[model samples]
Each structure stands twice: as C-alpha cells, then as structure tokens.
Target: MQAQDDFLKRIEKLNEIGIALSSEKDTNRLLETILLGAKELTNADAGTLYSATEDGQLKFEIIRTDSLGIAMGGTTGVPINFPTLPLYKNDQPNLQMIAAYAAIKGETVNVPDAYEAEGFDFSGTRAFDQKTGYRSQSFLTVPLKNHENDLIGVLQLINAKNLGDNQIRAFTIEDQQLAESLASQAAIALTNQRLINDLKKLFEAFIQAIANAIDDKSPYTGGHCHRVPVLAEMLADAASRSDYGELAAFKLTEEQMYELKIAAWLHDCGKVTTPTEVVDKATKLETIFDRVHLVDHRFEVLKRDAKIAMLEAKLAAMQGGDAEHAAQLEAEYNDKIAQLDDDREFIRTANIGGEFMSDEHQERVRAIAKHAYVNEQGEDAPFLSDDEVYNLNIARGTITKEEREIINHHVVATIKMLSAIPFPNHLKCVPEIAGNHHETLIGTGYPNGLTKDQMSVQARIMAIADVFEALTARDRPYKEGKTLSQALKILGFMKKDQHVDADLFQVFIDDKVFLRYAEEYLDPKQIDDVDPAKIPGYDVGA
Candidate 1:
C-alpha cells in the first residue's frame, strides 16, 4: 500500500514535469527539461537521452549526471556503433542492461537486482557501473515514441537509490511505468516542435516564391528583383566587416540578415500595380502608339500641297506665256520640300536622342509649326499644334506631367500592398523596409514622405541599389542606359543634393561591390566602356 502511494506521488511529479515541457517550444530548452525531469522522478544520480540517427544508430542528444567533474557544455553524448551490438526491435539483449534492452524491445525495462543477479547478464552494464564508484542496483529505461508510434529516442535513469539501505536499489515495475509516461509526454512535445519548424520553413519559401514571381513578370526586369537582394547582402557583408566604428556597431545578426534579404526581394512588389505600358514607355510622346508617326504623315501632306501649288503657278504662268515664272515656281516648290524634309529629319532625331528639352530646341519646334494646312473639313490644322510642337520638340524629358505622376505612383502602390500583407511577428519590419526605398533624409521623397529618422539602414541600402540598377540598366525602354562612370557621376550629384547617403555611396564604391556584381552578373560589354577614373577622386589603377 505504501509503495502504491509512492508510485502515485511519482506519477503526480511526472505530470508536473510534462506541464513544464508543454510550455517550452525551443528544442534545446525542452531537451534540458526532459533530462532534468527524468533524473528527479527516478531519484537517479545520472540520466541521458539518446536519439535515433538516420543511419540506424543511437546518438546522444542529452547527457546529465550528478558528478560535478564532467563539463556539460558542447558534448553531444557518445555514439554507439550499431554493428557491435545485437540490437533489434523487440529482441532481448544478451546482457541484462536496462537502457539497451528497453530500446531494442521498444518497451520500458526495469532491473531490481543489478549487482546480485547471477543468471542476469551484466557484461555491457557492469563496467560503467563499477567505474563510477557507485554500485548500480536498479535501472529504469523507456523508449520515447512520437505521434506516429515510431521510436524517436530512449530515456535512461541510472543508480536508483534504496530507501532503507541508503544504497542503490533495483528499479521496480512502478518505476518503468512512470518513465514510460514521461517519455510519451516528451514525444508529443518534440513532435509539436518539429511541426513548428516545418511551418517556418514553408513560410520562408513562400515569400521567396513571391519575389521570384515578381522578377519573372517582365522580360527586361527579369533578374532585377533577384539582383537587389544579392547586392543588399553584399553591402551588408561589407558593412559588417568595416573598421569604421559606427558601421561596425550596426552589425546584422543571422535573423536580421534574413529579414533584409526578404525585404530587398519584395522591395518593388508594388510595381505590380504599375501599368506595363508606362513601365516600358519608350518614346517621349508615346502613348499606346507614338503620335510622332502622325507628325510624319502631316509632313507628307505639306510636301504634296507644295507640289500642287507649284503646278498651279506654273500653269498660270504658261497661260501668260512666261517661261521665267515657271522656272521660278519649280525652284520654289523644290526648296519648300527640301525645307520640310529637313524639319522632319530634325524632329525624328531629336525624338530619339532622349535629351531633355532645351529652350532653344523648344523655340525651333515652335518655328516649324508655321506650315499649317487647311484640312478637308475646312479646319486649319497646323503641321503640328503649338502644344504638340512644344511637347514634341522638348526632346528627351517625359511627355506629360501626368505621365510622370503615373510613374511615381508605383511607390505609393508598393507601400499600400506591403502594408496589407500579414507578415509574422519576426518579420513585422518588412513592410517598413519595403516601403521606405523611395524616402530621403531631406524629406524630399514621395509616398509616405519619410525622413531619415523613419528609415532604417536597410531601407537606405535598398534605395541606393534601386537607383544604381535603374541608371545602369540598358534594357530600359525609355532612355539610353548610362555608362558606369556616368551612373556614378549622376549618383554623386544625387548625393550632393542629399538624395542618398554620401558616405554609404563612397563605402559601396571603395569596397568594389559594384564591380564584383558587374563581373558576376552583368554583361561585360555593357560595362566595358566605363572608366573608374572619370569618377571624381577615384583612381582606376588603385
């Protein structure tokens, strides 16, 4: 009756330990808790947990003992060579070893008389028991089973003490039952931990897939989203290695690095809302189709009209029998066609040059509008309207202020879309990181109009990377891509205007990060003409 009461108390203690394990999600903490509980419940001097390995071997995951001499840190329990033992599931052991026998049989094992059982084999168990200067009398071993009923590990308790003799006593059936109950609880906790880990991995992969999909959306921008993350990582790595005191202080941990990569990939996710036509806008006056082609048709009409006027004048002069008048009319007609052709040539080249409109160019374009025609509807149609000529002649800048707004709204859409995403707790900063790429220190940026204080270093790095990629991308539909030197020059001007961090730009250049990226990912021909010397204070030889 007394033993039964003692068993009940032990079961209550095991239940308390199980409750404690339930609260811990961290794998290391749970393993430690399991070992501590096993030792306490069995009154054992030492305990160890062995997890089954992929190769059908038992590997030690945790080992805890009462001896203060053994250093507990960094030792992952002993590896048992499976070939040396007659270990098979449900098979009996040659030696009456409690732990090994329980593992092989997939059942809890208890030994009540370890030292004085003549028929009981103790070949494998005796050596370790004798070496510890502690007589081993009782042993309790339980096989840890997962939810699938597969053996995950084994929990062993050693040197169970006898209450009356003050010596070790053999483990009883009651002890085996208690150990099995604890093992079952541990298996459930471990299974839950594994599920959580798998879910985390799935979430990360899903985010990466979304980033890849964004990159694959446009042919010209196919690798851009992918490249930004790579560049961001390189910059981060450089910052981490810098000797500069301030930069070194901002070192990124593994988790921060991961978050930064995710943010970088999704930085332009808002571009999805941006119209593809606007993104691929090639011509200055381009809408669905270029209106400049209409201008060419207008020039053709002027040529035809000039010819008809010459014919009319020549016929009237012939009626009056004046040969001189006819010759003069023919020359005048040819001159008008020549002048019109020259004007058309000028417009075509100017439109393609992609240079911003100069005041002189706009004036020339206004002067060409004098050759207006009377349409078949009796409406006077200027070869080009004053406004049409003005916009067409503006040469390289955007065609309309409205189009510029549409282009800039991509930043706004990006912020809105990212804000709607349900990022997990660890990734709560992702929306801020993705949205702040367009922000500046001087509050001159758009969308949220964030200042430097509201922006993180990750955001700043992304902003720089976006600008750099944009300036150097030859595949862009609108402007001719700048040479590397030109891109750097422009970036320098932007820095002077407080659009980007000057020090960070300098660090990025000095670290040769861009050069490394160009070599690895960019076409050699695209960057071949770049002269590092053209960048102020930069030495190509160095």
Candidate 2:
C-alpha cells in the first residue's frame, strides 16, 4: 500500500512539472518553471536552476523558494561561480556520486544529514546554509539533461520538509526521484524556447536587409523610401483627426501606422525591374536614345536649302534684269529661317522643363511640327511624322502613351511582388497600401482602375504625396522644378478638376503640413525664399 502511494505521488509530481514546462515557450519563463517544480517535488524551502554558459560556467537562470518571498521579486537570476560555489566536474566524486546514486542516475541518494554524509562532499552545501538563516538537513541536486544526454542545466533543492515534525527534514529517495524527473522535462522546454528565439531573430534580420537593399538602389534617390513612410504617417494622423462620418472608416493604429510606413518604403520596390533610363527620363521624347534632336537638325537643313533656293532664283531673275524682285525674295527667305530658328530654340527649351505641355503649348508645338524641313535625301519633309505630330499635339502629359503604360505597370508589379511575401499578420496590409497609391476616386487611375469607393485613406494620401513630390522635385532631368507657389497652383487646379481631394488639400495647406515637412526634409536651398502664405487662398486653419 505504501509503495503504491509513493508511485502515485511521483506521478503527480511529474504531472505538475509537465504542466509548468508547457505553460510558456519563453526561455526565462521555462527556467522559472523548473525552479518552482524542483522546490515542490523535493519539499525544499529554496530551489535554484543554473544553466551552463558557452564557456562551461554556470549562470543562475531561475531561483524559487518559500522563504525567499515569492521567488526573490528581482533576484530571479544570478551567476554560479567560485564565490557562489565550487561546481563539480563529471570526474569529481561529489558529481559522480550524485549522478550514479541519485535519482538522476535512476537510483536515489538519501542524505539524512548532509554535514555527516560519508561518501559525498558537503562543504559547499554547508557553507551556503550557514551564510543564510536556513538550516540544511538534506541536499538534493539533479542534472537537467535532454534526450541527447546533453546537460542543459542543474536543479538544486534545499531543506526538504518533515511532515511529522513540521520542520526542515532530510531529503528522501522519493524526493530525489521527483526532482530528477522535473529537471528532465525542463531541459526539453528550454531547448525548444531557444530554437524559437533564434528563428525570430533571423526573420527580423531578413526584413531589415530587404529594406536596406531598396534604399541602396539609387544614389540620387537616396532616402526616398525612408521619407515616404514618415509622410504617410503624418497624412494618416491628419486624416484620423478630421471628422469622417463613419466610425469604422479605415483609421491606422500605432501598429497599423508602422505597417503602412513599411509599405510606403516598399511601394517602389518594383522599380528595381524598371530601366534606370526610364526612371531618369530627362529629355523630350527620350527613350533608350533621343530621336527628337535628329528632327531639329533636319529642320535646320530645310532652312539652309530654302535660303540656297531663294539665292539661286535671285541670280536667275537678276540675269533677266529683275534685281529688285530677287532682293525681295532673299529678304523673305531670311525672315523664314529666323522664325524657324526661334521655334527650334523654343522646342529645345521646352524639353528641358520635363513638365507636361499645356494645351496652349501643344498648339504652338503642332504649328512648329508643320514647318517643312529637308531630309538627308534633300527632299521636302515635315518636321515630324503624322503620328509624332499628333502625339506632340495631344498635351496630355510629358510622358507618351507607351511610357505611361510602363510607369503604370509598376503598381501592378508592386501588388504582385508584395502579395507573394509572407508578411506577418500585423503587416498583412502592405500589398494593398503599396499597390493602391496610383488609384483615384473617379476611376480614371491605372493598374486596377480602382474607383474612389475602392480606395482607402492611405491610398489617397499616397497619391497626393506622389504628385506633390514630383511637382516640386528639382533633380528631375526633363522638367524644370516648380516653385512652391507653382506646385500648389497645379494642385489647386487638380483639386478643382476633382482629380484630388479638395478637402484634404485645404487641410494640408491650412495646417502647414508641407511647410513642416519641408523644414525637416527638404534641402535648405530648396526652401529658400519660399513663402507658404503666397499660395492662393492660403488659410492658417481649414
């Protein structure tokens, strides 16, 4: 009957240890569980678990004791070294005795009185008991070993209780057996927790590396990805403050804001695949190479031919004694070349601005396109083909239709790439936030052609930011950078046309959000002499 009760008690202790180990995957929490279980199994007033360092030195991972006031509050961990104790090596008699005869060795060491133990060393244990107020009647230590028989740590239990005397008593064989069993479970849990921590660190490093790669791609465009997130956050903050009718309208939390910032940084990640020439398109009708310059030279040739023809006709007419008529023809030919030169100069200057041509500019451009020139074959040629003339006359934007299609495809590529990434649950919105930037409320946008109803607040903010930045950017090769006043004027026109959110633009201007951002982010030279108040209908508050 007593044997059955002992077996049942050991099983109960083992069950408790299992529950403790499985409660947490954290390494620190697992160590605490080991200490608590060790104390309970051995009926000790105090218990500690010491994990070995890479250098073979032991560090106290956890400490628990009834007398220690609920696990020492802040004294959970300590170093186990010479000042603490002379730890035993495997060859040491004390260590061997514990390993060979204690419950860890599949036997049990019943030390009735540790100070009087005949076959084991008790000096270290006795000294520890004397330093504290605790009396040591028994000392039980177990090795926490994993399935591979590798030692993970050591568990030490002190002052086994005597039920009859209601005082500290010697450790029993059953107590030793119980502690060893608990230690074994702790080893497995600790190993598993370490593995989890390592994997998490690796994943975080990978994410940081990807962001850095994106940042490093273009030298002139440095910090572009970094700044987008910051601006996105500011916009989101402003949006949330404004009174939108629906409470459930998409509002960013701190975590959501962080995710959106990450998404902003990665929004142009697909640009990696786009040719650098396209990204830095610096000339009118520039492709891999510019062909417009050739057209300009052809026009110059036609002007030269026209002058030579007029001179020849004058010589012929003078031969017939019509001197006044010949001179008039020469004067008219000179005037034509002068006008053609002026138009050519305007075309060259116009390409330098990199801005989309306005309707008035396009009309002027079509007139220039109709001007005749001489080809290399010396035949009469219009300055451009019919299609080229049509394209030049459209005045839709700086980008040609083909170039616009390529630029628009980036949004599609962004969505595809981001969707394939296995983002964490908190960052699941990355793809949506990135891909939806080009979308508009009026269904005129590209990639997905998503309407306003399909767009989120984040998407709208991104669109505004993209357009504003492009308008104000000075480094672009093709177009002259707009002054702040000019850029705002354009934005105002866009708002009036219902292309952008007027309310948000009003809020942006009234709050001086752009000025605030420019102070921190724009170069001092870029901000010089810029007057925010000069913007049309500038309001301090909207």
Candidate 3:
C-alpha cells in the first residue's frame, strides 16, 4: 500500500512539472526546469542536459552538480565550455557516448556503474571524476522525443540517491519511468515555443518587405515608409516615459511594443496601389515626361514664323524700292521674337511648383493659354490647353485636388487590407493604429476623418510621426525639406489648427524627442536652431 502511494506521489509531481513546462515562455528557464525537475524526482546528485543539433551532434545545454555546488549554463548565465558530443564518428553512428548514443538510438540508457559499463566510452567520465575528486556512477540517459517521435535532445541524470539513507544508488525502474514522462512533456513544450518564435520572425519579415516595396516604388519618397516607423516608436517611447497628463497613465508591454512596431511598419502599406507617376510627380507638367518641353518647341516655331514674315516683307519692299518700310518690319519682328522668349520663360517658371504661388503668376498662365497656335491638323488651337494651364497654375503644390484624393485613398486601402487579416488577440489593434495615421484631431482628415474622441493615443502618435517626418524629410518630390525651426513652425501652426493631439505634442517637445530623431535622420543644414517661444500655438510654460 505504501509503495503504491509513493508511486502516486511521484506521478503527481510529474503532472505539476508538465504544467510548469507548458507555461514557461523563456527558453532558458524552460530548459532549467526540465533538468532540475528530473533531479528532484530521481534524487540525483548531478545532471546534464544535451540538445540535438541539425548537424548530428549533442550540444551541452545545461549542467548541474548539487553535491559539488556547481551550476553552469541555462538560466545561470554561465556558459558551458565543454565541447559538443558527436553522434557520429568517421561517418558512422557514434554510440560510444551515452548522451549521443541515447539520442541516436532513441532509448533510455541505464548504467548501474559507469566504470564497469560495457560497449561504451567511460574514459571522459573517469577523467571528470578524477579532476573534481567526485565519484561518477549510476547513469540514466533518456531521449526527449516530441509528439512526432523524433528525438530532440537527451536528458542524463547522474548518481541517484536513496532518500532513506541519502546514499548514492542506481536509478530505480520507477525513477526511469517518471523522468521519461517529464522528458516527453518538456520536448513538446520546447517544440511549441520554437514554432511560435519562428512564426513571429516570419511575420515581422513580411511587414518589412511591404515597407521596402513601397519605398522602392518612388525614388522621391525613398525612405518615408521606413522613417515614419522610427519616429513613431521614438514618440511612443517618450509618451511611455511621461509622468504627467493624459500620457502619464499609459504604458506598453513588450508584446504591445511589438504590436505597435508592426502597425508602424505597415502604416503606408496601401501605397502599393498608388500610381507611381502620380507619387513621383516632381513638377506640375510631369507625367511620363515633363510637358514643359512641348511648350518650348511651340515658342521656337513662333520665332521661326516671325523671321519668315520679316524676310517676306523685306522682299516686297526691295521690289517696290521701299527700304524704310523693310526696316520697320525688321524692328517689329525682333520685338515680337523677344516677347515670345519672355512668355516661354514665364511658362517654364510657372510649371515648377512652390509653397506659395502668387495670383499674378496664375493669371499669366491663363493669359498664355488664350493665345492661338496652328495644330498638326491645320486647325487653330490655344497655345496651352486649359488642362495644361490648370496643372501649371496649381495654387500651392504640385498635386491637384483629384490627385490629392488619389493619394489619400491609400489610407482607405490600408484599412481594407488590414481589416481582412485575422490578427491574434494581442495584435487586434494593428488595423486601427495603421489605418488612422492619416486621421487628425479635429475630424478634418481622411479617409475616416476620425476626431480626437474616436482615435486612440497610439493612432494620434502615428499621425504626428507621419506629419513630422514629412516636414523634415529631404527625399520628398514637391518641396525642399524644412529646417528644424521651419518644420517646428509649421507643426506649431498645425497644433493651432487642432490637427494633432495637444497633450501628446507637448510631451513630444518637453521630452526632446524631435531633437533625438533630428540627430539621427536630419541633414546638418536642416538642423537649424529652433526657439520654442517663437513657434506658433506653443505654450513654453505648459
């Protein structure tokens, strides 16, 4: 009856160890638990765990000698200096070493005494015992096979002890069975962990690939997709460190940080659907090529026509013997050609977009469009089409309203694409965070036009990151990158317009997150001095 109870108690401990192994997330701690549990169940004086490598070898993972007060490897932080035990020797299975032999043969090896063991190499064990002045005896090596019946590693316990007298003894049959069961549980747990880690790596790699593809789509916006994530993480880190205001109560765990990183990487994923020509539109006349050259060709044709007319008048005057009339025609031709050259230069300048194009400049483009020229069909047509004039006279930027809408559609596509994915519980917020980067605080931004009340702090942080990166980015197509003070001035105006989170922006400035990002990504010239007092809508005292 007592023997049966002892067996049940050992089984109960095995059950508990199995639960512990399944719950352990850290690889080192899980390995330590497996070896330590085996030692406790068997009352072993020492033990060593070996993991199987892909190259047919047993790598030493953990070693513990309780009686000698030695613990190396695993969670102990002490690396095992011993060489790996080879499972093969000279291209043949090396079953001489017990741990390697067990892993190769997929069996539990029990030796009552290592010195007297037959058909195996015990020379190393004898040498180890001699150096440490410790007896090496009664070995039990069990192979850890997963659910697929494939050996993953070997668990070897040395010098089992009898609890009654505390004397070292051979491992009993019951001790062998308990260790085998625990080994099975540990193997499955480790396998699950490896699968989870591999999936995580694959997912992160896919996200980065998308970002790279977007960057590659346009040379003008080369690093915008990559830099936004860096800035978002920086601001998030700053907000996490804040001790007052709305952000003070917020914090992120390791898992949440990874979730945020995925969102940032994929924030502009929808840009894949955007037309490359529009995304790379450097000038108003840009399509397949800048159409400004077409206008220049027309101006040259007009100049040639002026010269022809003047030569014809000179010929008529010579026939009539009227030299003064020919001279007047020459003067008019020269003035007309010079005026055409000036108009051509004006059109050329208008084609280039700027931050602030004057009303006068727009009026000049319209007037140029009204002038007539003969087309290839011999029909009279406006020198510049209405469409050409409209594009050239784009009020403040290179893109038109329709093109801006097309660019903004990327956010809508991002939400649609991400919403279709079945993210795990921890990453459920990824779609919202990524989709809201284009949203603003006052419900004026698109495609959802979410207000501050609808958006999370994470989404707001992404918005600021996206905007700030655009302001300081040197790789944009439409305009030159702003200096630090210039960028801050614009951001301050944005704050006044309620385009970003007020409290978060304050935390961003107070924490000096802008300067930190500037040092890493901005050019030396774009790092000009900034005065907080001069920045519009910024309260330095706040």
Which structure among the candidates has the greatest TM-score?
Answer: 3
A best-first ranking of the candidates according to their lDDT comes to 3, 1, 2
TM-score of each: 0.67, 0.61, 0.91
Worst 10 residues of 1 by lDDT: 68-77
Quote model 3's TM-score: 0.91
Task: Compare candidates 2 and 3 on lDDT and give the better one.
Answer: 3
Give every collision pair in model 2. 353-479, 353-480, 354-478, 354-479, 441-452
**What's the lDDT of the predicted structure labeled candidate 1?**
0.73
- From the highest TM-score down, the ranking of the candidates is 3, 1, 2
Per-residue alpha-carbon lDDT of candidate 3 for residues 1-542, written as tens digits (9 for 90 to 100): 98799889889999999999999988889999999999998989999998888888889999999989999999889989889888899999998888888988899999999988999999999998999999999999999988888778899999999888979899999999999989988899989988888998899889899999999999988898889889989988888988757887889887887788899999999999999889999889888999999999988877887788799988999899999999898999989888888999988877788798889988988887876677778888889987798899898778988898999999999999999999999999999999998888888999977899999888999999999999999988778899989988888888899998887788778888889999999998898887888988877987
Report lDDT per candidate.
Answer: 0.73, 0.67, 0.89
Candidate 2 RMSD computed on C-alpha atoms after optimal superposition onto the true structure: 7.8
lDDT per residue for candidate 1 within 268-351, as digits (tens), equals: 877777676666556655667777898888889889888888999899999999999899999988888999999998887666
The CA lDDT at 205 in model 1 is 82
Tens digits of lDDT, candidate 2, 355-469: 4567787778778877766667777777877755654544544466667678677788889999999998988988988888777767777778787668766777777777777
Give the Å shift of residue 536 in candidate 3. 3.9
Query: How much is the lDDT of residue 207 in candidate 1?
Result: 67
Positional deviation of 498 in candidate 2, in angstroms? 6.3
